[model samples]
Target: MSGVARQIDRPRRWLVVLVVAVILFAGAVVAPSTGITRMGPFGLFAWASWLHVFGYAFLSLTLVYALLVSPDGPALSAAIVPIIVVAYGTSLELLQLLIPYRSFAVGDIFADGLGTVVVVGVWTYGQAAFAALGFRGS
Candidate 1:
């Protein structure tokens, strides 16, 4: 395959996952009651909205993992992912306000941002440690 095609293949799955994640999360926010998601232990007996952040946290970890696996991945993308996460979370909270059942809460944003921070910090630190040891592969 040509260089461009090969390059495209690498991030193609990322793009797909990114889109699906956004859509699914959007669906969760647009009609949270219709959308049912469970996080098992991560739920911690919290409301589904809160546990939804936990799901995003895991999604963030997947994105970070994909970024780490890519040779051309940059720290800038690692940093920006959290911003995307925060913005997405902010938007979701705003959307939730429209739902009669869901009220916008500062707590949700805090939870989402906290999750984003944890994912980015852990991912970045792991990348640094792996680079030091010359580890590779997803």
Candidate 2:
């Protein structure tokens, strides 16, 4: 690692990731079209769905790391991160009900949850593999 990289702390890195994730989440929630309607005939399987997956997946990972690095972070177990991510997705769907151009779609929530789950699952598997190989970093 470079001296500059060593100078920056782990918590600071997690904070930056968390902030960017929040901004992305806010954008996805507020944007009017989000290119969903433009993907005609794709509907649930649209590029929009893929966008949600990737967006929320990164969001979930950031949130987990953020919580992990916080001073009082240990109060909330990391195991709850997936549930929190899914709940956030559901809340976003509910909020869309109030938006004129967006309707509350359960499918969107599912896509978000699926995305978070896939990412977290892969991360968990990777960590387990590393542990089995006697590698420590996660």
Candidate 3:
């Protein structure tokens, strides 16, 4: 493909990734947790906590990638992506309150925020390092 075509397609690809990530997150959040802890190596709360971290981390990364690939994306994507992800996480947690089988947990929010911060921090620093080494990054 031509460079122009590739450039135009990048944002679309990332947006698709972002959408998939969101759908997966919602599915995992709303699904019944009956057998999850028993199946996972980590017991009970640990498994759920790790899920919160990894899920939000992936979601945040996809969001950042989508924004970064867009021509008119925000100048401070690293700053905004975490806020967006955390807010989304919080909203999901609040939604759990209405579900009879699901209850809200503040710890899950903390895990989500932790994941967003770690991923965004590493991404920002990795981009800087690549730039310092004279490499172009997206």
Candidate 4:
């Protein structure tokens, strides 16, 4: 790697750190009755499942970006992002079990993991294509 390239990668290290922090915070957030937990602005808990899928998709995409930026940020393993996302989703569901109105559901976990898998697959193929085209700086 060129020295200039290495210098440019330094800033990305902080970006990866920020992304990891966001993922952790998002995973631990309490499920709200409306807003992000729901679909529309007025509807309450309407189409909540699709919200979970959407939220997790963004989270997964952020995680994939972090992995692509820095493979050795703390203990973050690119290969384990999907597993971690699924585990985080499972933990969220478990937390919901204690809430008064929230009910734990396996479907949420599936949706979250599905999001992670889709992002990971896309990132993997993107990197592969980049490499094939001689673009090595991820």
Question: How does model 3 fare in lDDT?
Answer: 0.77
lDDT of 2 by residue, 53-94 (tens): 887888778766666544333346556777988887787778
Q: Quote each prediction's TM-score.
A: 0.68, 0.72, 0.79, 0.66
Candidate 1 vs candidate 3, lDDT winner? 3
Q: Which candidate is the best by lDDT?
A: 3
> What is candidate 3's lDDT per residue for 71-103, written digit by digit as tens?
554456689989988898888888888888787
lDDT of 4 by residue, 41-64 (tens): 455444666666666777777666
lDDT score for candidate 1 against the true structure? 0.68
* TM-score of predicted structure 3: 0.79
User: Which residue ranges in model 4 land beyond 4 Å of their true spot?
Assistant: 1-46, 71-77
Q: What TM-score does structure 4 among the candidates reach?
A: 0.66
- The clash count for each model shown is 0, 0, 0, 0
Candidates 2 and 3 compared: the better one by lDDT is: 3
Q: 2 or 3: which has the higher TM-score?
A: 3
Count residue pairs with overlapping backbones in model 3: 0
* Candidate 4 clashing pairs, residues 3+ apart or interchain: none
Tell me which of candidates 2 and 4 scores higher on TM-score.
Answer: 2
Candidate 1's C-alpha runs over 4 A off are 1-5, 23-27, 30-50, 65-69, 73-77, 136-138
The CA lDDT of each predicted structure is: 0.68, 0.70, 0.77, 0.67
Give the local distance difference test score of model 2: 0.70
User: Judged by TM-score relative to the true structure, which candidate is superior, 1 or 4?
Assistant: 1
Model 3 deviation from native, Cα RMSD in Å: 3.1
